[model samples]
Target: MKPATAAKKLGIYLPAAPQDFQDSEVTRAEFNQLQQNPPEWLAELRRNGPHPRPVVAQKLGISISGLARGGVTEPLTTADITTLLAEPPKWLVAERSTHAAVRKQDLIAKKLHSESPKN
Candidate 1:
């Protein structure tokens, strides 16, 4: 599979992966092995990685746009994400509230849509 696809499956950030991993292609066997029984390196990467934006947002409990607004342009390691969550800044706090509001609105909208008559 492609590097990006592999990284996504592994829940890792491609740019932060090792050089060899970045350069090589992941065969089906390798992918399956990684899923079934990841090696030490793979385990380490998943545990403390430069996680992708979606994962980062999920970990931070904010939207991806929130990360952008908070000026987090680069991928963050698990440690960095942990620290941010542990000590949320003003922007993060504000964004989390905004995100929560947006999610609530979305839920309301979905309910309204479901209740509406079919056209």
Candidate 2:
């Protein structure tokens, strides 16, 4: 699979991946192996992403604008994310409701789309 696809499956940011990983294709077996038993590098990347804004926002259960409002201007490691979850600040608590609403809307939209008549 393509590196980006592999990265998504592993829940790691592609840009944060090592040069070798970026330059190579991940075979199906390798993908399975990574899923079954991640290497140190893969584990590290998943835990500490130089993730893009969208990924970070999604992980934090906030919109990009919310992140900006909260003064978050950088990629976060899994540890950082965990810390926030463990001791959620006011901004995060507020954004969690927004995120839940957004997810609910997305589910509603998906259900509607699937129920629509086929072309």
Candidate 3:
């Protein structure tokens, strides 16, 4: 797989990865190995992340759009994420509630749709 594909699957920011990982193609076996038992570099990246947008959103408990609304446009390191978690700003609180409400609504919609008669 291409580096971008591998990075996406790993939930990492591609540009933040090491040059070798960025330069190489990852075979299926290698991809699996990386997933199952990441090397130190990979582990470090995940552990002290300049995480990808989706990852940042998940850690912040906000939707992607909510991130934009909160001016969190850039990727954040694990420390930065932790700080946000520890002392959530008003926007963060609001966004979390909004995210939870949206998820609840989505679940209800899916349940209702699943229970409806098929055409």
Name the best candidate (by TM-score).
3
Local lDDT at 89 for model 1:
97
lDDT tens digits, residue span 27-119, model 1: 999999889998888788888987889889998989999999999999999999889989999999999999999999999999999999998
Per-model CA lDDT versus the true structure? 0.90, 0.84, 0.95
What ranking of all candidate models by lDDT puts the best one first?
Answer: 3, 1, 2
Return the TM-score for candidate 1, rounded to 2 decimals.
0.87
Model 2 TM: 0.62
In model 3, where do residues sit more than 4 Å from their true spots? none
1-119, model 2: which lDDT tens digit per residue? 99988988777777788899999999999999999999998877766766656777888888988888888887777778888889999999988888789889999999999999999
Q: Is candidate 2 or candidate 3 better by lDDT?
A: 3
As a whole number from 0 to 100, the lDDT of residue 67 in candidate 3 is 91
- What's model 3's TM-score? 0.93
lDDT of residue 117 for candidate 3: 100
Candidate 1 residue pairs in clash (backbone atoms < 3 Å): none
